[model samples]
Target: MRDYFIRRLLLIIPTLLGATIAVFFITRIVPGGPLEARMRQAMAMASERSMKDAGGSLSEEQKEQLAAYYGFDKPFFPAYLIWLGAAPQEVEKQFIKFEEGQNEAKVTLKTLLPRAQWTATNAFKVSEATVDRKGALTGPDVVGWKTKAEPEKQRVTVFRTKFNGLLQGNLGVSTRYNDRVWAMIKERMPVSIFYGLITFILTYAVCIPLGVIKAIKHRTVLDNATSVVIFIGYAVPGFVLGSLLVVYLAARMGWFPTGGFVSDNFSQLSVSGKVWDLTHHAILPLICYMVGGFAFMTMLVKNNLMDNLAADYVRTAIAKGATFRGAVLGHALRNSLIPLATTLGQIVTVFVGGSILIERIFDIDGFGMLSFQAVTDRDYPLVMGVLVVSAFLTLLGNILSDFFVALADPRIRFR
Candidate 1:
């Protein structure tokens, strides 16, 4: 079992690699990326400044500068490498003064590559170049200097690349929000986790015992009534239920807060007040989150327990003078839980897998909502960051599920 688990752990690398590679390449090939969006913004700004028809596009030089800034200047593989932190990326640029003479001042810039290797084929292709008043390179094409003419004393831009990305704990920045991807994730993670944990705990706490009761009271009015109620809940989606709850429970009845994770003045409230406010706000959303899962889990437990109780071992245990309750609890219940163990590891996704629609309806800022925004906005870095975290968790959850299955059914073994 240990060896089997180790092999499964090793397989995570390739699994994650394949998933990320496919997504990374797709994001690159997709149209309307960050570059195009930025260009449109620039064009809009230019149109506004000139107060003219929006027919003009950015110049070639402007496009080149934007491409380099966004790292689109490189081909697919190199850019992907830079994002993975396996290859260096442009981090900073600064122009340096080399020589100062009465008549002429000489400045030199370094490329990302070695100075000696790049000097000959450099964009400027000259030993020395003078800047014009307009901040453009006056000499032959210079590598780092602006293509536009600039003042002689203008500060020239020199660029430097560095090894900084996923491998270095940098998830990159959001193109749309202009914020660190990790920071944004951290800010919203707690809300999703809170919802997930509560839902998980409540689902198990209520469903399992309910299932056991239904199994023992099979075909009775109590069991049939519960089955009807749960099936009704299972038929309705969580988001739809949330909308209904918002309308009747919050808007008309005035019981719980309509939306948001907490009250506006929660910070100023006392500890007890804070707790009550949080609970009051959480009631509607939590109900919506748990409704679907509650029904499914209850049914799953009931069916599994019923099947196990009818098995030969459980029947024999009861026939051999063991009490009915003891036979059900000791023999049938443990075996019945084996199937549930397969999904136990899914608890990980709960950290970030709050229902997007449910969260949107509730006006909650959470990981799922953030992921939805990232994809819709085409924020590549943020999208990739979310994918990385979510993919890892999902892979890890599968392995944990397997481990749990093994634990629940000792009769089972791995080679």
Candidate 2:
């Protein structure tokens, strides 16, 4: 198992790399760039100010500066390299000489060559030069032969991409939120986990026992009634149920809060009051999240248990002087849970992804809603951050589910 785990962990590197590459290029193919969006926002603000205070729009030089600031002036591949922190920032510096009689100063475009050589072009021939202590030249030998003025330095970014983004825990900044992507995710994660964990716990707690009962009372009226109830819950979508609950329970009866995960004045409440307020706000959203899972998981458990009960080994156990209860509980029950155990991976994935529509309907500011907003706003950094986290969890979940399956069924082994 140790070796198996090590190998699986090592395999995640290439898998994640491929996933990131796909996400990066695919997002790039989207219709608009972040710089363009920023420009539009700036123009809109300028327009608003103009209407109120007679302010002018952004100048051409200001527009270029904005493009340069965001590194949009460079080619896509070079910008991508810079983003990955793969290359150093390139700066443009110009050397100017003040001639005695010339109207304009003699300007020589000098850039630091790859080997630290100062290469000057589009200027007069070199006559004399002075190198500084650091090998940086103060005065270059020029044919124009005059006093030197202050050199102009303009910084431009190149291959500056941070390849260690995932490793170093920096997921980059969101253009839409104007904040770090990780920070935004961190803020929203707790709400999602709160709802997801509750749904998971309750779904298993209720469904497993209910399934066992239904399987035990197969073809009885109780079983038939349970089937009708769970199927009805299953058929209704969580968003639809949430809307109905809001209209009937919140609007009509005033039993629960219509939307949101907590009261606005929750912090001012007493401890018990806080808990009650939280539960009140949570009731509708929690119900919406759990109903679909409850129905599906209950039916799954029932079918798996029923199949295991009819197996020859279960019959053999009962024939060998074991009580029917012992045969079912000790032998059949264990085997029945194996199939459910395999679904643990999917559960982890769902926990991370959350329910987008349900969260949007309830106005819960969870990870799911964040993702939905990111996609709609074309926030590439946040979108990619969410995708990376989801992908990692999915891969990790598969490994965990394999271990769980191995533990549940003694016949299953990791080599």
Candidate 3:
């Protein structure tokens, strides 16, 4: 069992590496470079105030600087090499001579930062040189200006912020937000994590029992009535459902908050007040999101249970001496899990990224909301990060599904 678990866990590294590579390539090559994201976001905020407002418009020169900082100025292979934790970056710069009296003074520095070597955020190496004010250059690639300042006087220190560490790994900073990529991940992920947990529990709680009972009492009036409800849930699109709920329930009953995270100043509220407000806001989105997964799970579990009813072991167990309850719960249900296992496998992929439409309609502040913003904002890093996370979850879901199936079925063994 330990060996099996270890092998399964080890598989994740290569899987994630492949996903990372694919994400890196897809994000870079896709139309509308990094600046497009920033531009779009700025426009979104400003456009609220104007008929149409362009925010933080970038010049061609500024665009070049942004690209250089991200090492997008480098060849694609070099960019990939840096991302993959390989290759020494070749640097660039020039030399300038200042005629101070008869004795001439020369300094080696960046073309951009005249007094210093501009530390490119994700750069491999930046060659230092001298260029005149008009933009002409002279001399060696490495900084070796003759100076009188002592031991390291000859050495020019480029602005070297910590780039490689546990925190700052291969992936560069976000093109949209000014902060580090990892930092953004930490800040934004909690909302999604909370969202995932809450919705998942709600979905499963409503689905499994409903499915089991419907299966146990197949063809009854109760089953028929339940089926109609489930059908309606599955038939209606999440957005349409959310809007209807919002208009009828929220607008009419005045029971739910329409938008944003928590109350405006939830911190100031009393403990119960905070809880009440939080639950009030969350209920509508939760109910609407649950409809899709819950209804589907009900149908899936019912179908699987029906199939398991005919499994050889189930009938054989009953014939031997087992009661209906024992035969169904102890034997058939165990086999039934194999089908539910597939549904569970799909959960991570489907649920994690699934509620986008619902969240947007309900105005829920979660990853789904961020995704909606990313599309409109055209924010590639946020979009790619969210997508890569989704892909990772999907792969994880498949792996877990296989492991669960093997664990549930003792006859199956990995040699």
Give lDDT tens digits, candidate 2, residues 88-205: 3333322333334433423343332354453464332233344222223334543222232333322111111224445556677788878998888878877877787777788888
Scored against the true structure, residue 161 in model 1 reaches a CA lDDT of 57
lDDT by candidate, in order shown: 0.81, 0.72, 0.63
Prediction 1 global C-alpha lDDT: 0.81
Give lDDT tens digits, candidate 3, residues 1-415: 6687678778877877676667667767776666554456555765454524333455444554456565576676666565555654333322223332322234444433543544655323335444333333345753432321212222221222222321235334455565564565555566666666777777777777787788889999989999998888888877888898888888888877775558889999999999888888878777776776667788887888888887788889889999988987887766766766654665565444536677777666666776667656556556556665666787778777777777767777764
TM-score computed on alpha carbons, candidate 3: 0.72
Report the lDDT tens digits of candidate 1 across residue range 1-415: 9999999999998887788889989898998889878877777877555434222467655676778777787898899889989998765433433334433344444335556556654633334566433344544546544432223544344444588888899999999999999999989889988999998999899999999999999999999999999888989998999999999999899988888988889899999999999899898888888889877788889999999988999889988999999999998998887898988999998767788898899889999899999988989999999999999999899999999999888888987
Q: How high is the lDDT of residue 124 in model 1?
A: 34
Would you list the rank order by lDDT, best first? 1, 2, 3
| Cα RMSD, model 3 | 8.2
In terms of lDDT, the best-performing candidate is 1
- Candidate 3 regions exceeding 4 Å error are 1-23, 36-63, 88-170, 311-321, 343-354
lDDT of 2: 0.72
